[model samples]
Structures are given as C-alpha cells and as structure tokens.
Target: MNTPKENTYTCLIVEDEPISQEILEVYIQDCPQLLLKGVCNDAIEANTILLNQKIDLLFLDINMPKLNGIEWLKSLDEVPEVIFTTAYPEYAVEGFDLNALDYLLKPFSFNRFLKAVNKFTGLQKNLAISDLSSDLTITVKSNKKTYLMKTSELNFIESDGDYLKLYRDEDCIVIHETLKAFQSKLPQNNFLRVHRSFIINLKKIDYLEGNQVCIANQMIPVAVSYREGLKELL
Candidate 1:
C-alpha cells in the first residue's frame, strides 16, 4: 500500500494494442505519484481528451493507425511531457529529439516502467521548485532607490565587500546586500553560487573557458569546491 503524493501527475495513455494498453494501465495504477486520466487507442481520440483536459504526462505509442505518434506529436502546438512506448528501437532517437522524458521499449519490466515514471516525478519536482521561485520577487535598495526585481530577469550577482552587484544584461546595480542574502532569494535551479564572491545565472552562461564561465562576455571564476556541482549542471 502506497500513500498518495501531495503533487500527483495526471497521465494519459495513447496506445493502439490491447495488450500494451493493459500493461500500461496496470503499471499506472501501481504508481502512487501518477493519476490515470484516460486511455485512448489512437492519436485522434487522444487529441480529443488532450483538448478537453490538462494532462501532465503522456504515454504515447509510436506505431499507431492514422497520424502515428510522431506525426501527432509534431502536429500539436503544445504538448505534455511524453514517454514513447514501442517495440521498435529505431524511433528512440526521434522520441528524444522531441524532448520525450524517456522511451519505453515494449515488453519492458515494471522496474523499467518505474524508471521512466521516476524521471517524470523528478522533472515535476524541479518544475515545482522553479514555480515557487518564479512567483517570488526580491526587494533591494540601489542608488538610494528601492527596486523590486524579478528573479527570472537577473543575469547574475557578484559580491563586492558589503555590497552586491546585480547584473541584468548591460545594466549593473549595486545593492547594499550580502551575496548570501541575495542568493537566498533567487531560484536555485536558475542561479548558483559558483564562487564565494560571485553567483552566476546558469541559464545566462554563454560558454566555459578553463575553470571560468563567460556570462554576457564577462569571465567569472569557478571555485574548486563548486566545480563538480557546476559541471553536473552544465
């Protein structure tokens, strides 16, 4: 018996074969993190449900009748996170190209199904964290004026003694705030403290050059302790 998770991901299964659909239905029921919304046998039927509801994860089978999985996926203006299920291994590369979370080869074990679901859970967790930070705004006093800054627009923050420099594109503002204090208000997924004196926006990075990261054409040092963690992110 598994307790329900606070954040459950709504899922839809679009597979043509009866045996495959049964296997997926059983697997989804056993996973506490997933909530089965609807099961459809073809892309056309799946499209109807997708338009009427909000699906967080989609278990799509590549080989289907009339507008096959790949064709259907490409047709959509907006698509949910997908996990491609198929007997053919040839479509694996194309599935990943479309940014499917994971590919499930047919006759896959419960363990393998769980692995793909875990990837979905992990992604949802990160998205939840990011959403929290996205809604938050930081208040700082710069140049004798107070400004409320959006966490998403911040390029980076550099520590300068008691003052912290907040960079946004070509503009720089000096706020009388400690680097640690400023970092505490930022999104952990988008911002990371690379050095004690510098915190760079992970998304704003242009390139890496020998222990240094170039953000907006400015080279920032990477500390030894944070190197491994930064490498993992990059």
Candidate 2:
C-alpha cells in the first residue's frame, strides 16, 4: 500500500469565536497536511506571533474586534496565504482582494474544510511550479468516478440540498458536495456566490437581474443577503 505523503504546513488561526477556533484546531489536527503554529483571538495577538514565528498559512476572521482581517492583511509587510473564515458573506470581495486562498462561511462542514485545504495545496504547488494562471483544471470524485473539469468551462453551480449541481455550457453534473465545497475549488476572481445555494462563474454570466443571474438560458436566483457582495464581484 502506498502511504499518504506527510506534508506539513504551519498555520496560524486568528479568530475571536472560541467554538470556531476550536473547530479549526480540530480540523488542523485531523489534516495530515496542516500543523498548528499558533492561535489568537485578534489581529494584534496574531501580529505579535507573526513577528516571531514563520507561518505558512493563516485562518483569519473578517470581523475581528479592533483591526479587521483585511486591515491586518494590509498592515503586514509580508502576508502568508490566507483563508478567511467568517459568518458574514458581505466581506467576500474584500477577502478576495487580499488574495485569500479560500473563504469559508460559518457553519462549514468537514467536507467543506477539506476542499479549502485542497485549494491551498493546489495554490502552493502552482506557485512552486511558477504557474500563476488562475485558469486550470480540477479532478472531482463523484459516484466513485473521477471527472476532470476545466474551470473555464463552468457556467454556474447550484446547491440541491446537500449536493451541488455543476453546469457547463450544455452539460450539467451533479456532485456529492456542498456549495461551500465547490466555492473552495473555484478561483475567487472568476467565481462568486450570489446566493447561499448558487455560485456563478463571472465569465459565464450573460446578464444580472435585481436578484437573479442569467447564464445562457437558465436563471439563478441571488439571495438578498448576498446581493451587495455579488455587486462588488461584478
């Protein structure tokens, strides 16, 4: 049997919510690729640690008490790859502006967490290979079968309860994953979650209604909560 490679990435968590922080720590422990370097309740504490220790990644919260995650990231002379974890989807654009690896909304599942980690790993690999292009392909396993999907071919993805429906030009594929999981796999520059259940490819958008996004002949509803953030992406 081939053993899983022991890849270790030092990570720092800067989240105020105790339960969320605990959940992240547990997930880090479970991931063979991750190593917990430190945890802090706010950016100030995280800054102190950053000055002393070398951190490979950061799991930061957008709504910190004093200095928000975006503010903190801007303040830093050198910033590591970051994955923002927050309850507010309104900060999605700001998170992307900071070049976050992925943005995890609150109440995320283990499967979703894994997806973010996978994206981070992919990013690191691409960086090592000096491939800075956001356009790429991803392999997804569904129904015990692996499918290679080009990111550019994706039009939009919709959540059907627990599963995600990925729509290409004329084809659609149902994958056993959440919208959050699919969001992690996509490049932030090209994809935007216009609703809790809908992630639309910016390049594929034919037009946008008040609360609806049109891709080809299909129209996807955009939730009121996500409209402001979606506008930023547009």
Best by lDDT: 1
RMSD of each: 7.7, 15.4
Distance from true location, Cα of 143 in model 1, Å: 13
Q: Compute each candidate's TM-score over C-alphas.
A: 0.62, 0.53
As a TM-score, model 2 comes out at 0.53
* Model number with the top TM-score: 1
Give per-residue CA lDDT, model 1, range 1-234, as digits (tens): 233357987899999999999999999989978989888999999999999888899999999998789999999999999999999999999999999999999899999999999998999889888777665687889878998877777778889999998999858989888888878888787889999999988888999888999988799999999999999997
lDDT of 1 at 163: 92
> Over 4 Å off in model 2, which ranges?
1-6, 131-234
lDDT of 1: 0.90
* Per-residue lDDT of candidate 2, residues 1-234 (tens digit): 122344667889999999999999999889878888888999999999999987889999999898988998999999999999999999999889878989999989999999999999887786755434457799977778899988888998889998888888877888898788778888887888887788888888889877788898899998888888878877
